[model samples]
Target: MLELFKIKKNHFVGIDFGTASIKVVELSYVDQKTILENYGFVELGLANRGNMKPTSLEQVLNDSLKKILAKMNIHNAPAFVSIPGFSGLVAIIELPSMPAEDLTKAIQFEAHKYIPSALDEIALSWEVVEKKEEQGEVKDNDNFISKLKLKNESDSKSGEKIKVLLVAAPKKDIEHYDRLVSGAGLEVKAIELETFSIARSLVGDEPGVFLIVDIGSRTTNLILVEKGLIQANRNIDAGGEEITSAIVDMLRISRSRAEVFKKEGKDILNSNESPLVVPVLDLIVGELHRVISAYKEKNKGSKLDAIILSGGTSKMVGIEEYFAHALGEEVRIGNPWRAIAVGSEMAPLTKALGASFAVALGLALRGVEDYKKK
Candidate 1:
């Protein structure tokens, strides 16, 4: 059985480790509102390219975290960190209902069927999403005595039938993050999958089937969420760097110059009469369309309600309009910090932080209700 931890209304920090940068959000819960205490980000000098050996990347994480912590004066705080979507496995399945005590064993057995690793090699966790009686119709019509007897039998047999959402992460990956945060002089209050965080921040309290596309420095995460539940998630190998590299090759510019152009080129492309970047964008958009089409085909009969574009790359000028035009769907840039109150002057910084921090923000916002029960 999974033990629930009580999360209190205390100051907490969320650190998002991305390929090119680290984003840190400090949140304070006061007067029933989750306030944005402070936020900051730092560029990773070593792994900016998104490819690094595990050990080298660990060093970069440590260094960048140290700098960010020092700059933010975050000496002691309960921290919540997230594992990248590419690093873990998440699935929703139906299982036989039983006493909460037996649910863990049942989930572990079911997890073995979906997880590629040995059961012992991964840390497994599950949450109950729905519960329903399988044979309550006949019992509902019975007399009180007979109904009571049927309920007893049903409870006993319920062991074989129930549904659940299971999430598993490789033990090594979990330990790596645990060590990383502990080494940084911060206590890890909770660790969550990145996709789950993105779902919470982007999907919010709305009820609909929406697709959230997060284009990060090294990878693009495409997730299909329905009614606040994640139906499917896919991580593509291409991201902002690929787009920038294309610009570098076409314009024969250095990587740094290419990155600058990638962000601010629409104005220059219009006025300077330079070789347009449309061909490259077309390729990127084409690939995105294929991914979306495949997702739609797999989920037939479900129309996508909207497309939410998030991540640092989405901040590029005209990207939202380009996606809206290409996909023939409503496209809105995701602002993870939209719910929190930050000063108006920091709006641009918040925009630049992008959808990449959605997960971290949600994880950090792990509510006081959760803590109160514990």
Candidate 2:
């Protein structure tokens, strides 16, 4: 995560540069309410998802962002951007409580175990998510004297355990997104992982654990969020593109035609052509089960409240019903715009855009949250 500029604007922009398209959302905060101002999206052909080189992709995104901003008449706004889930790491580590200085060094050492790149190549960040005593009770970090007393009492037994949320992203990936926003004439206010943005917009202040299954064009991000905090994150290489390819190969149709068929085919998951798509969904579901099981095994006595589905592919008809049946859990599509105010003129778009703009909206909401804090 990168924080470069201070919050100084009421109107904020969020850009989600996905593999298949670029989504931009502009929001304005007024009178303690967040209102939707403008939004734009440009679809990058599914067939060209992984074929484009890095430099080519950069040029395409730069041009697309510039065109979208110019068309929407949004200029020079402070932008919050999201790095793809596959390009970053989110891990929850538990260690015996110690001094602040020792904790910092311990987290750095733990980061090396999870991050493949060297420490110098990665931009690492961490925070003490919570501290727990031997009896499984949470300890407040703010009450230093009380916490010290409790620690002293517990020193003879088991020390208090600190659970830290560790986040790491490559420096090059950060610089890549920074250049994308800067080239489009927007100041880079902050850069965060897509997982955090998705959680912020969809699961804000919601109690209980949620697994956010964000199926993008080329990858699926399986985020296990407990009380709006990311507990475990897993990304799969299969996504909408894989489903589209199955349709193309099974029906012997062109990629462009298959793309349209995917969005228009109502109840396709249960139809005869269901074979083409169920595999991809099943792949994601299989990963979901593994992630949930791992999280449960690690943190006993915790239950996953629900599964929230987001991303373009989630807009498919009957998807919610299909997932509910498959997982036997309360499955629903996320509404990122639920808390944002939209006028009658834009109300019609709420359902159509539904879960697709979650990352973008979450990024924009971060700016609003920061402004409110100031």
Candidate 3:
């Protein structure tokens, strides 16, 4: 999480730089309602994903940004971009509460416990998600928060447990985005984790804990959002491309045909009938089960309300039913338009690309709201 700042801007342009493609969304206020002014995307095949120099990826992204800007007729706007999930860390930590001043130092000391890099190697930011109730309250955090300290350890007024969402991004990663955005002739106004942006746009004010399954081109990002704050994020190497590759290998088909088969082959790909894609989906489900079980144990056997799937791969015709059957939970595709006001002219485009464009649209919407607060 970026610290809350006092920056102001007019137009909100969000650039979601992904492994396989870049999605840009430009938003403006019309009659005090956010309107989708322009949007565009560029597919940069296999450039920065696996093995590519930072400089080469920067050049490619810069060139792509220029083309997108020209095609959308957007210019002179402050931009909010997302840090890839693989390069950042987000976690929920609970500790004995104290003054705001002392809490900052305590959080820094605690960051070393979870962050892989040295304290000085990464930039750390955090915000208090909630001031949890003290021992034996309605909240189901008995397994962890209560263990941080004894119930009589501190005074009731000041020793209440506080839970915060911590975010860490490497300094080099920040510098990389600085160069990429500057090289594209846009000032970088804000940078946030991609999963956080997706939650903001799609989950909005929906209450309770939600498992966000963002299956991207190269990886599947699993995020747990509790009471609207990002609690935990986990990433796996399996994704849409890998699933397609599995299909291609199983059926001896081309990548294009495999992709089409995964999305359109309804009869052969049903939840029970599709043994070919079952292993791949189950691999993802196994990881999800780990997170779910951990969360339940930590939260006193509570279960997640629903699983919201967002990404290009989540749009498969039978994916919702498939995952629901596998996980035994309600599953549905997220709607990106739920966060912003969309006029009739952009309805079809919003529906077609909602899942894929979620991150970019979220950054823009959150940016505009944050700007308005200034």
Best-to-worst ranking by lDDT = 2, 3, 1
Q: After superposition, how far is residue 372 of candidate 1 from its true place, in Å?
A: 7.3
**Overall lDDT per candidate, in order of appearance:** 0.69, 0.79, 0.75
Instruction: List RMSD in Å for every model shown.
Output: 9.2, 6.5, 7.4
Q: lDDT of candidate 1 vs native?
A: 0.69
lDDT of 3 by residue, 1-374 (tens): 55344323567899998888889998875556777878889998763355788667777878887888778866567888888877777787888778777777788888888887887777777656564332222111111111111123224456667776677777777777767776776777777778778888877667778999998888788988776766678988767887787788889998888878887746444746545654667888999899999999888968799999988888777778878988899998988877577778888888888588888988888767766667
Give each model a TM-score.
0.78, 0.88, 0.86
Best by TM-score: 2
Which one wins by lDDT: 2 or 3?
2
The TM-score of predicted model 1 comes to 0.78
Q: Model 3 segments beyond 4 Å from truth?
A: 1-9, 47-49, 132-156, 265-268, 271-274
> What TM-score number comes out for model 2?
0.88
Model 1 Cα lDDT, one tens digit per residue, 1-374: 45344433377888777777888888877776667777888988653444667788888788888888889887677887777777777676777666665666677777788888887777676656555333221111111110000112123344465445566777777677778888987877777777776776777657787888888887777777767667667677668887788778778999999888887747433334554464545665677677678767976876788889887877777677777877788888887787787778877777666776776676666533234335
Instruction: Give candidate 1's error at residue 320 in angstroms.
Output: 1.4
- Measured by lDDT, the strongest candidate is 2
Worst 10 residues of 1 by lDDT: 141-150
